[model samples]
Every structure is written in C-alpha cells, then in structure tokens.
Target: MSEEYYAARIPADIDRPDAVVARLTFRQVAIIAGTGAACWLIFTAVHRAAPHLPLAILLAPLVLALTVAAGIALGSRDGISADRFLLAAARHARRPRLMVHAPEGIPPMPSILPKAWRRAAGPRPAPLVLPAAGVDGAGVLDVREHGYAQIAACSTVNFALRTSGEQNALVTGFGRFLNSLSGPTQILVRTRRMDLTGLVADLEEAAGALPHPRLEDACRDHAAFLAHLSAHQQLLGRQVLLVAREPQAAAATDAGLRLSRRHAESGAVLAGAEVSVVPFTPAGAYGLLADAIANENPGGFQ
Candidate 1:
C-alpha cells in the first residue's frame, strides 16, 4: 500500500467579515442603506415645502451625487475600502508629529516664558503611552492593570527541507503545544538589521591561534569576506519571540508564578519539535522593549 498525505488550505484573512445581503458585508449594507435613507428624507422635506414644484427634476442632481459618493466609498483599492482609507488618512493628519515619553502628560509651558515665545514654540508634544509599566529583576513585565508578561526567544525549524514523516511529527508536536495553552499566548516575528562586526572581530582574534599557517590564512580570508559583506550589503536577521501573559490577581506573586509556569511548559513542548526556547534576562528584556518602542516612535522615549 502507498502512503497518502493530505493538506488543508486556510485563508489568510481569517477575520474577514461575513456577507449578509447580496454578497455585501454588514458594514457595506449599513453604509448603502444609510445613504439611501438620507437621500429619501431630503427629497421628502423638499417636496413638503413646495407641493407645486417639480420635485424629481430639482432633486435629481443632488440625489445622483450622493449615490455616486456612496458607491465610491464602497469601492475598495489595494484590498482596503475607500471609507477606511479616508478614516485612516484623517487620523494620521490629526495625530501629533512629535511624541515624548510622559506618563503624567506633557506639562504646560513655564509662566516665566513670554506668551509670544510659547506660541511660536508650537503645540505640546503627544505622550507615548507604552503598555509595559516596568520590567522586574526576573524578566517579568508589569503591565499595570492588564497583568504580567514574560518573553522567550525561540529558534526556527526548517520544515520544508525535512522528510514527509519528520514534517508530520513536527506538525503534530506543534499542535500539541498549541492545545496545551491555558492563557493568552502570542508569537511575534520581526526582522532587524544584522551586524557582523562582532563576528568579524572574533574570527580575526582566533586566526592567530590556529595550529597551521594555512589554517590561519583561511580564517583571516573568511573574516575579511564577512567584513566586506557587512560593509557592502544590507543584511537582515529574523527573530521569533513567544510571549505569555497572565491577568492581574490579588497576589502579584501568583501572577508572576503563573506566567513563569506557562513559559516553562511552552519551552518543554516546543523542544519536541526541535525548537530551542531561551527566556530573556531582565537586562535583555528591557533592551528588547526599548528597541521595539524606538522602532514604533522615531522620536523615541525622552
């Protein structure tokens, strides 16, 4: 008998809205209905005011314009609806251009400063509200009312290169890990610019310690190649992070303990799939948070 393999296809847009009427989503239907209602109300009000007037001819242009506008708003470009794109554009225009780290809020200008000078200085910068309150010594994040969170760095697996049986085993083990989750868990994948300066320096330092001259030359040549690559080309490195969060409880200790246990269980389960998980230290966690925040806000925290 021959072995059989089956694959399931899942849509990328899992959260896409369901169609309610004529293949249109609820939001689209509401927009279209609301526009028609508004147009009808306008026509009725005008008709009541002037019973002898030619209502259809007078209101025809107004109604047509409104209908066209509604249709345009319903249309989507590049997978984004026109209405949503306009809303996002409006929000971007209204948001502050500059942001500063101020938990309490941006303070008012000192009374000592001249009114004209203060006016010329422009509006106060917006505050950068981060989710994390602080990181403790144990690498646990205090998220205020939200609760505590712990992060672990995870290594990737090359499933495409593995044999069919190995791939099935990996998938089964990963499924088991997902089934074991008891609380909120998040997997974040990001790419950052790669730096090879440290690697090049290490290679050069070890080259002199080689037993043979030929070996030393080869090491030096490899180090030079790495240095040239780093200097000439743009390189990026991928990072996979697992985040486990526990909601706030009466006892803070209990929340931390729960988060830690979840992290350990995740590591143990992922190990079956040949994924190594390493929990970040306090300093490492703080650094990661800072880098993430800096990326989001170009101005960075003050």
Candidate 2:
C-alpha cells in the first residue's frame, strides 16, 4: 500500500472583487455608468443653451475625454485600481504632516505665540493612537477595550529539508495546533537588520581568556571575520512570533489569566511540531513594540 496525498488548487486572487457584468467588476460598471450619465447631462445643458451647435462638435471631445477618464478609473496599477489609488493619494494629501504620540489629544497652540505666526505655521500635529495600551511584567499586552494579548517567540522548522513522511507529520501537527485555537491568534513573521558588533565584541573579550594560545588565536580570527562581514555586508535576522489574544472580561485579572493559559496551550501544541515557543519578557515586548512603531511611522513621531 502507498500513502495518499490530496491537494486542492486555491485562487491567488481570493480577495479580488467578483465580476458582475460583461467581465467588469461592480465598481468598474459604476464608473462607466456615472461617466455616461454626466456626459448626457452636459450634452443636454449645452444643446438647450445653443441649439445651432453641431452634435459632433459638442459630443466628440466631451465623450472622448470622459471615456478616457472612466477607462483610467477602471484600470489598475500595481494590483490596485486607479480610483482607489487616487482616493488614497487624496487622503494622504489631506492628512496632517506632523504627528505626536499624545494618547489624550493634541493640545491647542500656545497663546503666547502671535496669531499671525501661528497661522503661518501650517496644520497642528495629530494625535498618534497606538493599538497596545501597555504591557505587564509577564509580557501580556493591554489592548484596552479589545483584550489582553501574549506574544511567544517561536523557533522555525526546516520543512524543505525534511523527508515526505516527516513533512506530513509536521503538517499534521501544525494543523492540530490551528484546530485547537479558540480565540483570536496571529502569526507574525518579520525581518530586521542584524547587528553583529556586540557578538564580535564578546568574542574579542573572551579570546584573551582562552586556555590555549591556538584557541585564543582562532577566536580572534573568527571575531575579525565577523567584524569584516558586518562592515561590508548587510545582514537580516528573521523572527516568528505567535500572538494569542483573549477578550476583555469584567475583571482585568481574569483576562490576563485567560491570555496566559492560551499562550501556554499554544506552546504545548506547537511543541509537537518540534517548535519551541518562548514568551517575551516585559522589557523585550515593550522594546519590540517601540521598534515596530518607529519603523512604521518613521519621522511622524517625535
């Protein structure tokens, strides 16, 4: 008897809008219809005003321009429709240029500054609303009204190097973990620039204390190689994090307890798949959150 493997083909465009008419999406159809209606209204108004004007002279250019505009709106660039891209661009243009990390709200400009100078200073800074309210000593994040979430750092599995049977086992274990999830869970994978300067420093410091001269020399050479590598090449480090969130309860302590239990359950399940999960400490979790915010907003926050 042979093992059986079943596979199904899934569309890459699962989020794509469905075509409603003539292979055109509802949005595209609406754009075309709106353009046509506007053209008709213009044509009617112009003809009523000047009955002597030729229809071709009035219709040709107007229809051509509107049709092109509608076509552009229907078209897509970089996987996003032109209409959506334009809307996003307009929104970005209207948004405040400066943002400050004030959870309460942005205060009014000082009364001391002259009114004329204040007017010339452009728009006032907008408040930055972050998702996580705070983190506890146990690394559980307080998401305010949403709930508490605990993040566990997970070790990766080398699926590509595994045998067919091993791969099947791993998949089965992962599927089990997914099936066991009761609340909102998120798996995050991110890459950050790797800094080897500290590692090189540690190696250099330890090299002098080696028992043998040859061992000391080897350690020194390795440290030099790492320093050279860090200076010449860009290195990236990948992190896999599992976040388990439990909805807020009447008592905050109950919510935190539920989140911790969920985190432990997830770790136990993942262990079957040869993956180790370690929850981040308070300081580590806060540091990760800060770094993530800085990366996302860049110069927007002071």
Winning candidate number (TM-score) = 2
Candidate 1 lDDT over 1-302, as tens digits, reads 54445567999977778889887888888888887788778778878888788967858876796777677657887888877877888999999899777767888899999999999999889997777878877888888788888899999999899877788879888988999999999999989888899999999999999999999999999999999999999999999999998875555577778878888898899899999888898889888988876565433322
Candidate 1 segments exceeding 4 Å error? 1-3, 44-81, 207-221, 295-302
Give the alpha-carbon lDDT of every model.
Answer: 0.84, 0.85
Worst 10 residues of 1 by lDDT: 293-302
Give the Cα-based TM-score of candidate 1 against the true structure: 0.82
Clashes of 2: 0
- What is the model-wide C-alpha lDDT for candidate 2? 0.85
